[model samples]
Target chain A: MKLIENWFSERYSDNLQLSFRVSDQLLSVKTDFQRIDVFETYDFGKLLSIDGTVQLTEKDEFVYHDMITRMPFYYADKIPEKALIIGGGDGGAAGELLKLGLKSIINVEIDGQVVEVCRKHFPKLTASFNDPKVKLIVDDGIKYARNTKEKFDIIIVDSTDPVGPAEDLFNEEFYSNVSRILNDGGVVVTQSGSPFYQPRGIELANKGMRKSFPHVASYVAFIPTYPSGFWSFTMAKKSQIKLRTENVEKGEYFNLEIAKSSFALPEFAKKLTL
Target chain B: MKLIENWFSERYSDNLQLSFRVSDQLLSVKTDFQRIDVFETYDFGKLLSIDGTVQLTEKDEFVYHDMITRMPFYYADKIPEKALIIGGGDGGAAGELLKLGLKSIINVEIDGQVVEVCRKHFPKLTASFNDPKVKLIVDDGIKYARNTKEKFDIIIVDSTDPVGPAEDLFNEEFYSNVSRILNDGGVVVTQSGSPFYQPRGIELANKGMRKSFPHVASYVAFIPTYPSGFWSFTMAKKSQIKLRTENVEKGEYFNLEIAKSSFALPEFAKKLTL
Candidate 1:
């Protein structure tokens, strides 16, 4: 007797890959921008992939969303009232931002299909789309960042890796445009890729953000579903970026100590920012 | 066209696995203790596997070795003179300890074949084995810890996962014996498995060590090749554990900030200690 096996793998490089045994492919769609796929896995729960890369898993999405959103929110000088989330079509970032009592959140995603698909399959992440404060816009984030007339207290570039549609988001011009649309003392944070597997992600984001903002810092979080299980995020602010309070509420992966310690990068990763 | 591909994968669970494409299988041996295999990989350099789990990879071994050895050494009240390493057959732990100007290091490994194989495939890690201050003891580490009269300034439990040959190492009896064989103000550090994948590793170590030591704390480091790319370590000391200095010479993954921040556990991981 022969047994049939099904697996979904994301190849980090020619030599390294991570595989998850899947029970079924829940959804596969070819959007105008990229292909989005979701799978039902035995261990990681629901798995989401974009362009053959692991974006988030049901079991570990809290780590990514919590770090990406809460780190900058708490570090900002003031409680941000208005937030602009670029490329967060899945609504996870917007959901996290909403908890902070923001007056408004504008999530500009390039692909409408991603938002539609996520709304169908990822109810928890996409639930924020229906919130009165969250305004979902299916448009190019780069264009929106460049042309927006409104000012924001916080801008989160929750984009994919600096490739394909999100390539422009990591350049100096995009950050300069983003800086122009920010209120005084505003903070902007971008999701840099894994420093271990893709050092250029942080390097490019850091180099670009440094050109636009007075102070920029890079921090990391452990997202087991992502490449190498280590992921990076870069924050740029008009003022200093420091811990605002020790009483910040803790999430699954976020706490007062982690907020401070996440910036303590390994030597190899620290060198990438320089 | 016909294409051939070779890959070595370690299944962490029925649903999850990590695979590395190998250029060649350098060696495969079965000793009295376990099966040892070595492979030359494309990205990770040489890979070493014992009992089908990644023990070390040339690319990321520094993260594991540095955290396991240096954190406790730096946190110790005084400079550690004598070090006892249990089950670190790869010699990486001893190599790091030697850098701290230790008086002597006794490495008790159950399987001598792991040492012999590593010496041939990974000369850099095993180079410290021949150092005058280092003694190679081919014996059961648990037995040695239970019966030995020697006391150490730092005892590092560098064993594999708490299973098979290392099962007894995580019990209260072993930690009690380890505490007895430590000099005043001595510290014992054990490599807890990934808290995300195996919470029991840290739980057991923390439970057992608390029985004997006045202070017990668990910390974590990012090891990409490990099961979840996140790993935990537990340290037990007779006195309070605090940062000793700020000028610890930086390793690839160890720095003064890391020395302090490694103790900041994620909320989920922190709950495991309770």
Candidate 2:
């Protein structure tokens, strides 16, 4: 597992699965399918396929980088002045936030190894490292959120799934802190888990966000590499902000209409919030 | 692989790496990240997984089933007195046509294995098997379409990806035959490939459908099981027929609003059609 780590990849989400492939190995992984027997070839900030299908190439990262960043930006009412990213040690989130031309941005990540890994393997992704507007802090996101004395225009939870160190990110306390650190009219968005298979997690996260903010909604996009392809994201607003999707639309993946439409929920999904 | 295939599992797709686990594998796959070897199983239907990074599942038949049967029935403006389902070996498309209460329906499927497989592995999915209104014609859909004397109100092409024997299903000759067999105001809908992954396929299928019908429109839906979760279907009307989604309202998946929106294409996809 030590052979491959920081290969660049882009991810495209459909309503079915999240697929990741390595350009070097030509190894691809889709929902229910993988090129078997992968070994880690390096310690770069990405997952690579050596003997099986764990390649994190540029294309795979492309989808995530575009989606988590671009989707929310489209809906943001204004070009953000300040931003905070929780997790995202790989700096992809910070990289995307920097593109927003924010006045200031802080990336709070738990794993210093992950940060160093990003610095080495994904230089293009972490190019925002030296940017004047960005700060990289080696701290758990929840702790940072709880202690933050400053407010931000947008909060992006680019954390890993709620396991291991990230489990705390899923708890209600973290959500409360997230709300506390937001400026007035601030909006927060995170990738909530799957809707097709483990709907409960998404529902639970949605509930947590609901308690933290007056306006909370879950919308979905399809990431083929994920288990069920139907991946969801939950958004919380400090105010009843009409989703801020406006004409700043230069995103390759997201647009104004998609930004609005994505917030519309299906009944089975709506049942979760109830 | 043999050891893991025995485990029954469900996969959930979130924007994070895909999650998979045993159905009662005690701990279901979670975005929370603690589980090791999170996606290790590969049911024959769940084709692939990579150290639980990317999880793919059995191809879902629901999105295709709902679109093909309903689109034509809604567009025909006449009760479907007779219907034909080409290559709907899974029975999902057949089941949808049954919902329209057609007097008689024929499903021409070349592969008995596909039908048998769906009945065994996806029984509730193949529930249309027992319906008396449906006649299972175990033959090549193309051959049947070429020879059948009976005029049909609607015909649905529910074939596989165009890589194998299903290749001919997208050509002009087959659509020409379909046009000859349809009664006045008759219509057709065929599953085009994922516009996100296979944009050219959708465009070609739409082009073929257009040659046979005066009115042709393409609609898309997010299906997590397909390559991109965004699957498109081409609907062609034989005559100037009042169309769009019927007045039918869906409780969860589809509705008039989404129907209109699904037809809205991304510029890349639109450029393909042009």
Task: Show model 2 residue runs off by greater than 4 Å.
Answer: A1-56, A241-248, A264-267, B1-60, B71-82, B112-130, B143-153, B179-187, B196-200, B213-217, B221-230, B238-261, B264-274
Clashing pairs in 1: none
Alpha-carbon local distance difference test for all models: 0.92, 0.63
The TM-score of candidate 1 is: 0.98
lDDT of 2 by residue, A2-106 (tens): 554333222222122233323244223332211222222222224533123232344445555556776666555666789898877667777877777777989
Error of 2 at B117 (Å): 5.7
Residue-level lDDT tens digits of model 2 in B87-176: 776677777777767888898888675566456545765788788988998888988989989889898888765655677889889999
Q: Quote each prediction's TM-score.
A: 0.98, 0.75
Task: Tell me the lDDT of model 1 at B53.
Answer: 96
Tens digit of lDDT per residue, candidate 1, span B201-273? 9999999899999899999989999998999999999988977795688899999888989899989999999
Which sections of candidate 1 miss by over 4 Å? A1-3, B1-3
